[model samples]
Target chain A: MIKTFTRNDLIRYIYQETTKEENTEIENALIFDEALCDELGDLQLTVNGLGRIERSPSKGSIDKILSYSKYYNMNAVN
Target chain B: MRKYSVSDSQLISLYKNGNEGAFADLVNRHKNKIFTTVYMIVKDQYLAEDLLQETYIKVVNTIKSGRYNEEGKFLPWVTRIAHNLAIDHFRKAKRYPTIVMEDGSNVFNTLEFSEDSIESQKIKEDTHALLRDLIKELPDSQREVLMMRHYMQMSFQEIAEATDVSINTALGRMRYALINLRKKMDKLNIAYDKNLYQK
Candidate 1:
């Protein structure tokens, strides 16, 4: 009973970028479309999960990159 | 964007006028971004470090020789230089065709944002690792957009400017990336309990 939906529909729903009609359509699909539910669930999880990944670079990497000044630019202050 | 650490525009003006400190400041400000971008493309930390130096030298010389077209705008110009050098590295290693795209499109997986809550953090970190591996298998162009948006904290507008694409294209990439990621995770049967993030 999963109403057939397009990629655009899912995009709108996930971003909450959908209209009320589209939102209702997607929410309704949740009742019948097990696969869609799983996919939507996974999409939410992935977006949320991605929010937890470590975005910062390794410590000292910035210092190491600046180390280049030592070789080329004689006047560069470290 | 308000001269937090001497912005790219300010540094470019200083450097153009022959101020030595400007060069160092510019280097300090962007080293991490340059390093990370290079590392992603080269996939080797050591080589990325080297390419970083090479990228700067080229920028310096390009500016010094007066061949640089970007009069005041520096980061975008420098970024392009770094990207070019990375492409050169892959080319010299005979890996160009596999790595460099004519459109200069390089994509990556969603970034793992760092958090402080230890309790939920551990589970989130585990789930992050799962998605990270799956994303690495994606196309470079797709992966790059996802990484920049999620990890680098770039807005869609910034991403489009950085990637030389339209806003629509950037959003399209993000949309497609999410959908593809969901489909891939589904096939892998990875499960993330909802209660984890609710807290």
Candidate 2:
């Protein structure tokens, strides 16, 4: 039986969020569904697009964290 | 001199046994994701930094109190703390409004970009900065899913459990996040490499 996939299903497939059985099911469904294939392609592009957006905490933040840990260490030892 | 290649679980155990330096190592290791996760949710750099410190303090307390026992999963465990603290801040501030705007404006103008000589470099950097801006404009729930899935590297099931939502709900949020990003990209006339998926 052919299965109808939702956008959520496409997301799970694109991100590898599905289980093995679900993956097999989605892969099997993708073979005959041109539209699903296209949607997957588009969503994959969006997913890859997200890689461009990167963020890191400030160095001051890291120092603050380490300083806090240092205080905790002093207290725990005493 | 402790080796720098220690695993999180091992470092955690060392901290539990009173080696506080190990705790610092653990915090340093996961600092980027934890801070980014908190910052994305709180949307204030200063407040996120405060919460980031508080989150580690709480983790230290939790481990000292003999509460943390799950081994080899330190990243997810700490992320759960970070997410909870961010949510608690949102609740206390009463600022988590479910406002979804159809038009992407105002928020996109805040990010500063540097000038690049190479055209490809310019496009790459601009696309990155633009996507970061658009992400801040996503609805609160969608943004959370995107951060957890893409940044924190949580599975759908793990995200659902951490956020206390259903797997289908988590999946739906991620789908909408991508779709919304695509729409914004088109609306803003930002041209990403069409063959991005192929590479």
i-RMS, every candidate? 6.6, 4.9
TM-score of each: 0.53, 0.73
Q: Which 10-residue span in candidate 1 chain B carries the lowest summed lDDT? A: B101-110
Report the lDDT tens digits of candidate 1 across residue range B1-199. Answer: 2256556777767877867677778776666556656655675555665677678767766666567776535665566677678888877888643332212111122233344466555555556555655666677778888766654545667778988998677777887788788778778676655423543
CA lDDT of each candidate?
Answer: 0.62, 0.73
TM-scores (chain A) of the candidates? 0.58, 0.77
lDDT of 1 at A23: 85
The CA lDDT at B125 in model 1 is: 51
Give me the candidate number with maximum DockQ. Answer: 2
User: Candidate 2 on B54-80: residue-level lDDT in tens?
Assistant: 887777767877888765377767787
RMSD of each: 9.0, 6.2
What's the TM for model 2?
Answer: 0.73
Candidate 2 lDDT score at position B79: 80
Instruction: Give the Cα-based TM-score of candidate 1 against the true structure.
Output: 0.53
